[model samples]
Target: LSKQTKDPRKKVRMLALAHFFEGKSRYQIAEYLKVSRTSVNKWVKDYLDYGLEGLEELPRSGRPCKLDDAQLKQLKAYVLDSIDRTEGGRLTLEDIQQYISESFHIEYELSAVHRLLKRQNFSWISSRSI
Candidate 1:
């Protein structure tokens, strides 16, 4: 059953169940599993309350991205096309930042802009040759 489950947490739960059935104390089980006593208690409670389904991880909530997928695709296409038509075919970080502000109406920090570009597989190359 543990092998079938892909989540490591579920595997841990299975181990906890095994130890629980063996009549081990919650503290002993926690020590064996290298987890906190509180975690073991919660897992046992969850198993009793919801069975196997309760052991699954809950979905997490996080901050939403300022730019949507369509907007990102459009931005990539626009920047690449603009670079093709420019003199040296290179864009500075500030230039990209300004373009994002004007086109998407979203302001990002210089570091954030660099991270976004890197995530999109865009890199900086100096146009001037040494």
Candidate 2:
């Protein structure tokens, strides 16, 4: 079970359980595992309250994306297709922002637009006349 578990916390919990089943005190377990006594207490409590599943990390709440998956896919396609096209010339961040606003009817801040572009692996390059 320990070998199959990849997370270090989970492995520690497994070891704690093993020591617990071996009639070890919480202080003893903490000393042997080199973890805090509070952590051992919490692990034992979690195991008793919710079994092994409780030892796993809880789900985190992350910031939701401004655009949905379909919108993102459409944006990617538009950016890729617009590259090297004569109609719009080289695409810029402002141009992409305008396109997004026009297509999605959502206004995005300049920084947000830049962040989205970067997240999509799009790089901005400046062209200079020789």
Candidate 3:
């Protein structure tokens, strides 16, 4: 089960339990797993308290996106259209940043703009000018 799991953290938890069941000490498991003894102890405790379900990751609430789906779609269209509208058929991050600020009335850091474009499937190479 540990070897098959794609999630590295879960794999560690499963392996820790497996090692414990095999009569390995928590210190031994920690050294073998390259994890802290505290972490190994916690994993063992969680398993004893809640079974296999305790090893699973809990859902986390991350920061929400500034733009919703519809707004993102509109932004993508506008970016595509900018190439046709520009003199050299080139669109830069500054141009997109300005457009986003003017059209959406929302200010985003240049890095955040880059991340947003990436999330929308716009590659860095494609979004750049010659």
Candidate 4:
């Protein structure tokens, strides 16, 4: 299940692996599973290569990670715990994100801040009414 898995394709491969391990031949698995034999073989190979998680497709390509979680949490704490909190109370998303940009020594774009906060279940409200 995607809820329990970080990799969806791995879930599929896990199912296939289960069936094959249960003594089903690849052709039977393929026919019953409505997948090409090659697909079944590939998933099985990937399963063997790196276990189930490896069956999930990786990001096609990327530069690489430049930061780590401790750094990110430190930045979030700075933004959430240190920024303006008064009768006005609490940094707005933009303010917090801007603070993150300045304080983290990283240049995060506005959209990136929105995405990150959204991932964190944080949201924005109108400052004047906020």
Best-matching candidate per lDDT: 2
lDDT of 2 by residue, 1-130 (tens): 5577899889999889889988999999999989999999999999999998889988779867789999999999998888856665567778889999999998898888888888889887755332
Among all windows of 10 consecutive residues in model 3, the one with the lowest summed lDDT is 121-130
Best by TM-score: 3
Candidate 1 lDDT over 1-130, as tens digits, reads: 5578988888998899889989999999999999999999998899999998888888779756678999889889977886777456467788888988999899988888888888789886657422
lDDT per model, in order? 0.85, 0.87, 0.86, 0.71
User: Cα deviation in Å at residue 57, candidate 4?
Assistant: 7.7
User: Could you tell me how far off, in angstroms, the CA of residue 14 lies in candidate 4 after the best superposition?
Assistant: 1.3
Could you arrange the candidates by lDDT from highest to lowest? Answer: 2, 3, 1, 4
Task: Flag regions of model 3 displaced more than 4 Å.
Answer: 2-4, 69-103, 110-130
Off by over 4 Å in 4: 1-9, 21-41, 48-61, 65-70, 79-92, 115-130
lDDT (Cα, tens digit) per residue for candidate 3, span 50-82: 998888888889878888888899999987787
Badly placed stretches (over 4 Å) of model 2 are 1-62, 86-88, 128-130
Q: Write the per-residue lDDT of candidate 4 for residues 1-101, one digit (tens) a residue.
A: 34686665666677788898999998988888788999999888877888756677776785443346876677667756644555566566577667766
As a TM-score, model 3 comes out at 0.58
Worst 10 residues of 2 by lDDT: 121-130
